[model samples]
Target: MGLVDTLTKSARRSSTTSSEGATMAAGYSAERAPDGNPDDTEVLDKEEGNLVMALISQLRIGMDLTKITLPTFVLEPRSMLERITDFTAHPELIFGAGKIEDPKQRFLHVTSLILAGWHIKPKGVKKPYNPVLGEFFRCTYHYEDGSEGYYVAEQVSHHPPISAFFYVSPRNRVIITGELKPKSKFLGNSVATILEGEDRVRLLDRPEDGEYTITMPNMFARGILFGKMLLELGDFSSVRCPSTNYSCDIEFKTKGWISGGYNAVSGTVKGPGGTAGEIAGHWDQSMEYKDKGGRKQVLFDAATTKVVQKLCLPEAQQEPNESRRLWAGVTRAIKAADMEAATAEKSKIEEAQREKTRAREASGQRHQLRFFEPVGEKYMPNIGVDRQVSGAPLAKQSPDEMARTVKEWLFGEVSTSPSQSVASGTQATPLPPSASVSHFGSETATMASTASMQSLNSVAAVPVHVTAPGPPVDGPKLSIPPPHAH
Candidate 1:
């Protein structure tokens, strides 16, 4: 949405039903606006703009650093449905009024919930709020440099987050479009914090020099998954990843630990799978293994043993001192997770492609995979109609009733105004023209913010550098401008 919808003081605040009540729908009202600067009014070069334009100009190519970074578990949307089925799974996280009554709906937890800004919610509650009917969250871009500008979302939908924050790039379907660069360093009420060095956060960091040496005291220290039974042992470390999802020649290294528990680490991670000296933290640490080409692998158990010794240092030195030797362990499960996620995403794309092919075959036309569709004067959904209405997608009760939820959620019926040129009887809209799609104007501003944030909290330099390519302005830089004083 534009400034009037997402950021305007007058915009209405809405909420989807809390699992607290059964059959309860969303309640909405105008919300109290936060006292902050407005969207862009002046021309901001990269440094001052908080608008999406400032973060990225164009989508980068190749495997995204984010796609392969951290554990593969971080890639796909979380399974919210499983929790809905078992309220006890995450008792404190439930809040929907509908969930409380229909035990079924509450049990049907989904990954995608509507992003509602209007609902009046109690502070510190984990259940994410959804927006109300007819009320759109307007966004106004205000550069910290005091510049002013405005842009609107393509259209409003149930998947507010997916629509407003991440659209598929018109130039590249694989590229996640739009910018989510928060105007401020952090969102005041975000339930999860990924700051480096903060024990409260799952992951935290502190930057040193040319590199950012990140240390996750115990990554996933207290995480809960389906199979993990009581206090189980897991790997932990930090990642200096590019904000965007694209692949490129990047560098990274981690040095944390492996306590005397069930196989500490087991995996291998190499940049783009094409870089040199590709090192991976593993559990097997096999002394020898043959490759497809029939050559024995180099740097096996011997190298890993040295890393294990380094990790054995006093907790203080292992986590705090870079001089203690920098060698982070990768795990096989972690590597499998990466492979599984990639396969899943690829499968999703391929299945989608096959369906399109069948549809075209039925119509006597060959399927043409066009990644980019011009949004000139019109906005279309990033995924396009090819995927919509395909299969028996839940056209049934609202999203709250679905078996699987997604990151995107909306609480009302969808209706776009001024639409024409019907496709499948319903006029197809372009993504940019809708008040929900076109926020990511550039990626540099996004990375610049990441770099600046790391600079402020880092204690050691991370030799491993990960950055998703941006609109080719001037490449990487030393520093981002200081926050503008109001």
Candidate 2:
């Protein structure tokens, strides 16, 4: 059977009664559920099995999976723009990290904070909705200490598929700005999403410490063509703070055919003097950190951690281009297990986007961004920074002033005009000339192969000394074309 046909049949079999489905199709609940379950494995049903075989038949060993269309059953009920929030779910870990009297202790807290975010993911081998061009998502966090954090993200570019985001907790003196450029490829029985871009976090009060840069591990969906399907984070990632002269290289180990376990991670914390400590454990369970003197500490225990949920405005109050409101139709259909309706709703959105692109092309006008603007090779928030200065620095504004500025930047003038309400369509510009050969050349393929062969038991046992700083360890580079259409 064809992939869609098999998927439809499977969905029908698993769907609720007609009456229940009809009621659910009327409207999805406004209450947002948590992103994913704690479990990572799913046994394929008969139809899903057929669909997987059909999908594999159409693929090559190293083909890019971006243009390929997948079934609705494999989608998480959220947009990738919102999925980025998972990294910031546990704010308490780094709420006052900058305030620590010792710089080394502060850097350790920051390392733990980065490790805390990876454990929360969707159940099974599900992918989030590829955010349409110009789609945006915003939410607020109300912390226990009565401080509030604001976050906003926009699908800034579509051709190369870039999503830029900004977050700030003024009272907590924390700020984060980053972009994500995920490219997926089929790797035999497994699929890998090479997580590109960097996440920069700055503590406003600790200007001398500089900003910390973090890279993400690539996600692998293993055993897609055979065996039990499971999600794994494979390869290397790093956390570096230049001012503190400290860095942590993390290895998210993949399972081996005969031996290695899932989710195992091990890394060394290095500083100017020498190795400061070592970190080891399962990412989905508990991770431990041992200092040079052999003092062991719990870095993060997923079993005992409580994730703080983000709060969003009502759908009715959100702008037309907001992620939840924009994808509401498809989300409802998917939740109701109505594959036909889901496909139709999803097509409607995609078709509308195509029409917009055509209209922009005809007029020879580029899609104007609403919140972020391209700054050199990266995008930066139009607000929060003092543009009057040569190198834009955070405006010396009070917490209330910053909040007001953010509110205005997000909502803008409180007008009801259609122009003010909706974001523009995809940019008319093509990819930059450098993008074709930028990084991720032949060397990356070799790196990926080398990473896959690494065993979980190979973590180094001895501390290594470092006399000088080296280049920051970032995610593996990979050249990828634009993908994830619907």
Query: What TM-score goes with each of the models?
Result: 0.18, 0.76
Question: What does candidate 2's lDDT look like per residue over 160-209, in tens digits?
Answer: 78999988876667788889999999765567899998888887768888
Error of 1 at 419 (Å): 30
Positional deviation of residue 458's Cα in model 2 after best superposition, in angstroms: 56
Error of 2 at 265 (Å): 1.0
Error of 1 at 363 (Å): 31
Reference-based TM-score, model 1 = 0.18
Per residue, candidate 1 scores C-alpha lDDT tens digits across 162-270 of 1122211111111112211111111111112221220000000111111112222121111111111111113343322222111111112222233222222322222
Which candidate's TM-score is highest? 2
Q: With candidate 2 superimposed using the best TM-score fit, by how many Å does residue 432's alpha carbon deviate from the native?
A: 48
> What is the C-alpha local distance difference test score of each model?
0.20, 0.66
